[model samples]
Target: MRLSDVWPVRGVELRHGVLELRPMTEPDLPTILDRLPDDLEMDPTLPRYAALDPGVGRAVALVQGYWRAMGGWSPQDWALPFVVRLAGEVVGAQVLEGPHDYGAERVVDSSSWLVQQRRGQGLGTLMRAAVLELAFGHLGAVAAISSAYLENAASLGVSRRLGYADTHTSVLEHNGRQLQHLRLERDAWHGSGRGRAVTVRGVGPALPWFGLDGERA
Candidate 1:
């Protein structure tokens, strides 16, 4: 059987204007690893633990983890990982992860990153909106949550633009230093006007993977 028939979420795709979000496939990994800049710097506002190092080895390891996660996914505990492409070129990634009872809990956590050159052009907002669309619109998520270090203004801005509100704050020790974490949440997302332009494809086959097929009826 085809992979999509076995794990239908693999077939899903989300798109808005020039930006596209789709499950990361093995074929897409090498291009992402090669095109990601060697000098790429992590956002200073993020905790050190959340940062991406600038090195070929680090990138390779990252992709290896991604592959492992995809291979091991189950309906009970899965990560809906997508590669963000702009006009057909790989530029970044967005991931929505959930626990063993995701379908019933209806909450998902998200993380994302874009290449430095693509940071300030509203692409981040668009990319995030697309995923939020998938989370709430397709997967029946009641709330989406994310975290950023207090110093990460860009990430905070995108959350705000997309209707996420500050939920709480905490501190964590990372790299021998304490970093502030700002939790954000959107509990009432209904694919609001923010991502109205975003369109999801391949969802029909994927709904069963997320246990949302009955709801779709």
Candidate 2:
């Protein structure tokens, strides 16, 4: 996949009947504020203060800054976030992050979350798959990665469905406890080759539309 196309970074949307991700708007703020996930608070893996760490702290802060800059969050760089929708209702946000224009060839890392109401319905797997489509299909991302709390079976479960193999584990603190972390790489994803086929159209206006060989469209 080509990885240089600069997306709108404003109001991008990924759609599939019943399952979709749209940009955040003022009206959506209520839903966003109302439905944000508190996984870190409930997970045993997170440290009592993992959220304070520079990496995790920066990650969350950057999301806030980006949201404020756009006056709301949609999909954009470093933290390309989205409002995951199901049957026209807001459910969560899917994020693509890590270094953009990473290294020479370009790579991306994905992260995502859905409100408590949407969990256990298999929506998490679909949402991450949707993020992959954005990264590999339109963004021309040469490769990708994903990470999750190791003990968070549900999150890891989604990775498994999307073909992410276990990389290694690290320990960190979140809300107020220690949590194990797991990493996933693109090579393992390809080797597994098990995620559902996700396709997108009608995104021309949101993207710079790079050509097949990765030159300008």
Q: Best TM-score goes to which candidate?
A: 1
Residue 197: error of model 1 in Å?
A: 1.3
| RMSD for each of the candidates | 4.3, 7.1
Tens digit of per-residue lDDT, candidate 2, span 59-126: 45434544553543223334455778777777887766535444344567766667787789988877
Each prediction's TM-score against the native?
0.83, 0.67
Model 1: lDDT equals 0.72
Give the CA lDDT, 0 to 100, for residue 58 in model 2.
35
What is candidate 2's CA lDDT for residue 179?
36
Q: Which ten residues in a row have the lowest lDDT in candidate 1?
A: 175-184
Clashing pairs in 1: 45-151, 45-152
* Candidate 2 ranges with C-alpha deviation above 4 Å: 1-7, 40-65, 68-77, 98-105, 173-196, 205-217
lDDT of 1 by residue, 37-92 (tens): 55543334332333544475557555765865677666666777789999887888
In order, candidate lDDTs are: 0.72, 0.58
Q: Which ten residues in a row have the lowest lDDT in candidate 2?
A: 208-217
